[model samples]
Target chain A: MNGVFAKLRTGLAAAALASTALAGPVSAQQVKEFWHYLGAGGELEGVEGMMEVAKSKIDEEFTHRVVPGGSAGLRQQVQVSLMGGVPPMAYQVSAGLELNQLAQSGRLVPLTEAWEQINGDEIFPEGLIQVISYGDEKYGLPFAMSMLGNTWYNKGIFEELGLEVPTTWEEWDEVATTLEENGYVALTSGGGSAAWTIYQFYAALFDAAGADGYWEFVGGMMPLDDPRFVEAVDLFEAHFVKYFDDEWTGGVWSDGLDRLMAGEVAMYNMGDWASGYMRQRGWTPNEEYSFFPAPSLQNVTIFQSDVIVVLKGEETDLGMKFAAAAASPEAQQAFNAAKGSIAPSNEIDPSFYDPIAKMEYDKLVSEDAIVLPNLYVLMPSGFKEDLGNAFTRFGATKDRAAFDEELARLEEMRKEMYEAGEFGTF
Target chain B: MTTLNPLAAIPFRQRDRMTYFIFLMVPAVLYVAAYIYPTIETFRLSFFEWDGFSPPEYIGLENYWELLGEPRFRNAFFNNLKWLVFYLTLPTVTGLALALLLDAELRGSVVFRTIFFIPFTITTVAVASAWRWMYKPSNGVMTQFVEALGFDAPNWLGDPSINTYSIMGAALWAWSGFTFLIYFGGLRALPTELIEAARIDGAKFWTILFKIKLPLLWPSTIVVLGIAAVDSMKIFDLVWAMTQGGPYRSSSVLAVEMYETSFVMFKLGQGAAVAFVLLVVASIVVMPYIYHMTRQVDEVKE
Candidate 1:
């Protein structure tokens, strides 16, 4: 009788397994494609990870696919792909030109219904919402938010060097000089093919240009002949050039943060993703590494955010569901904690973040913190490349001749593009 | 069921025509659709201003007009020209030398040939990574070797003046194996009697290489140079992976510039113009080699 019972139990278990296998494909026939820049071993793994967790919350019988690509590469790919009449359900794009152009093309589904689905106005700050929206329509869901002017350092290195958090230009210079004197690379910052690698200097330029000048400088309203612009360039030379490592010119932004984590350098200037990357690499935050808001501009926040845009199609329902889940307090908290970035939803409590991210996030929400867009985020991409070429020359040698000539060329191009109506009054 | 041939009802001559037409249709259509059409469309697009959005506008030759005075475009073009010169010389010479060395019947010749051919087997991405690490600042293999020899090494990828050559060195390292394999195959087909006759005449190895082998290797030389020249124009992956045409656009090539303009800058019209110019340059390069090869083939047939 016992042997008979065992055989019956085994048959029942096999029957259950077969039924589940039969039901999976039937249920998963409906699916959504989520395109993002996981970029192989990045701090943004949370974007994909939380998508997996959010799958359970997706009430529809829809499966999801994560399509990985780099930021700029994905933009180009999406451009070409959409030209072919097939686009992924959603993709990672920055707020400025990428979103603006895509929105203009009528390829994206505006977030009217999706924003309502996600509870956007209640959770996200107006600044973030403004960043992701254009033409008064929300077009994307913000996943990663950074107060872009934070400086990351090896806490152990700082303790060993007896360095304190620097607040002024003079103090920062002295601290950097001491680190260099002791056998440390005072700083590490680099850029690759993209429009990054100039942001670190942009932060300093912010301080040099002051609050009003910085805003005007980024907005194309600032004159090319502004003495403050020249001072800003000089400030970049004094801070970034003086302490740069030998390998600073040809790498992506992450390389510097990686070096900081490796303790080969004393300091780095980037967004809060540094802490996330450190955690991903098994470093305990505030122990192995630490971060501080970029000095002399604590009142100003240079913001960086990555957003997902829903494409209009039969799968819009599933895509909107994914976007809504991404904006949920639980999902945002889980994702941002893992990503080393702050949740886009401002309602998330500060305690959910690590010390570095919390401090940065608190400022982003603080009454006195003023939001400024980095050139990489706000400027037109063609304008960005023109600036990139000029910055490369400006970075190596602060040659006034080359600087002035490039500046003139840029202004001319901007004038032509503006007259042609390329910038579109944004 | 019996299979039937529609051409069976026709005369043999007409059937032959029909068979040939059917056989050639797919590829001919493909060539027109994939290659010829796009090339021609690019020319048309070059005259218009299009941002991949909105309707394209007729901008006359404004895109081409911008290039005449653009310093960055000039830098990229001249850099490509430098690559053209480098590819025509280094890989061919090094490859010819290695092929001659390995064309012997010595023991372990296969091992030597394999060792020399290994770099070509590795993909360009992996090879670029290896070379980039080898050229890393202050602590890389090349940097350390220079330092040991009592010299301060410039950052290979950071210095504008030297970065292109540094990238070319990596390209040549991977490409030499390919050139060697091509020459080795050519050498295998050479008449052994010529080598034996020279050796019997007390000819030195240098004389044998320069006079008999190299003179006979003319066909291979033309083909190899043409391949390298055309391949050199499309040199983007190595530069993109290694330096990204950087340290100040000193290493920027036409392809990288075209990519940035079209994709990053969204000036598809201008990017099309750059592509057109590169296409013209590539054609100018390959045309002479084709003429030379065809002439050689005719002489052989005669």
Candidate 2:
């Protein structure tokens, strides 16, 4: 009876092996999970496109878990998951201090080998690469880069009003006046939306402070009483706050975008993702609408990127391969096309991008483009929130005294942060 | 018929006590694990600076000190106090008034009660969304109504001066239904003879309501106030969903501040400090009520 049972077991094992062989190599394929907060609309499409592109470049199968909540939500979920020791193969994060801090905590796997495999130094710009790197190691592979210092406008409105794309602050002010005289919202956004309102400040600050001064400001070396800083605040107020109509207060960012498309607003200064949103809504770029880099004293590109951070784990090798795939020119092209962002890699074929994106791509690679990370990307955690709150209040109340008080507070905070060496090599 | 009764040797009183304790053990353990442990952990975390992932550095009372000096914190703290005061009084009064009117057995009172109760049945998020539209400055129902009367409509939500009150109004609309149900149940349980006697003695409606009915409704009031107090203290969803405690932290409360600090800012220790402050405030406000309820229970037992 024992001999018969052993023979039966051997036969079953052989049958199982034959079935596995019939199933082919596909059955044995490694499956890696990626977690991201890009759950809806263009971002979701972009992420899916990137994953599909990655699959063609790598042997592993990638599955995605759409984490709800935007960056803040993703951060909370990632922190909890990492603490619980069940982190995924990779997760999405902004490509600066957000990644650098995680790397500092030693929770992330350095993508140095993956970077070398992908020829990262040659393809990706040195500045952006350094922004996403920690010390001498890479921890994030950027997939989508958004130029925040750009203003999207309705081409038809500009044509109808016989106005030109403003390339300077004076020209911009004149254009805004023309739009307002024609009973259009001059510069529109979700007035109650704190983050976008804060971006208005960052963009204007770049325009007002100039690239070098802005760098000094971010480095905490600029004095609080700097005229450029005051001018930036004034420009932010005039564009983002004072012109904001009461009707717009109850709306969100998308609502502002909708109003702009509908010709209710003349212009919206936002990240390139606004273009992604516009494209998703069937608006053709550079036809019905167009954009220009935010009016600046000198050419500047305030950019931020979304990166895939590989976790340090058993699936680390698979994660690196996935990151490498994301960094590949083909994947970057596909992802950026869907995302309405410019490819981070210089090797990407710009012919695949729309005209506006192609222009952005050119600017991104241009040595004359004074590239800097967006304020949120440049600042550490608390500083961003503090600045955002101050801007939010100023945008709503337009109280100069309160704004000055906040500036004072921020100056103190900057000193403390600088003293503690919190500005991590940005 | 049983082989041997193990519990039979035990005294009846002790055996009953043992059964009670065994039944209580499950919930007791669960309570300790879920609520008590987290509360204690939060209190401990309040004393340390943590960024969710990094090793927590001991910060002692610095987080608390910052909260004190922070204007946003003061704004949120005051907003919470306003919520507590309004929630404790407005809803209870509105509910009582509705209950009394219904108890009078006027025509269509049952339908009125159901209509009034509808807001409570809908989720707070839905209610807040609906009210937010109504409060909108441009073409909102409230704005149109005000304009129709030949007056300017205030920016119900946009104006920092009135945003908190506007939100409180929505909360009142959603909350009064619950309080009405409680009061209605309490009123129904009251003896009819007492109210009839007051009427026979020529007591006015107001007099009868204040003197005869309201005093008897203390138990229900206590229940309502207890719920309202806690609800106001931890109010987050409606405020967050509606204004996100904005146009600028104008309508922010302790709960919203805690959420922003912990989740949005990732200042876990500061968030914990905010939470502890809220917990302390809530305890101080509710302790007297708890004691009163305890006394009420003890008196009834005696």
The model with the greatest lDDT is: 2
Strongest candidate by TM-score: 2
Candidate 2, fnat value?
0.47
- Per-residue CA lDDT of model 1 for A231-272, tens digit only, reads 877787788766776676645566777777667888987676
The residue-by-residue lDDT of candidate 2 on A1-426, one tens digit each, is 999999989966775455333322111222268889988766788788888988888876668889898888888877666655566888898887667778887767899888988888888776678678888898898888888767889998999999999877778889888888999888765655567777877767876787677667766676667898888888877666776655555555676688888888878877777877888789998898888876662366778888889877778888888889888888888777776678888887788888788878778777786777776666766776777767767766678798999889888888888888787675
Estimate, for each residue in B94-119, the C-alpha lDDT of model 1 and write its tens digit.
99889988888778999989998999
TM-score of chain A of each: 0.82, 0.85
- What TM-score fits each model? 0.89, 0.90
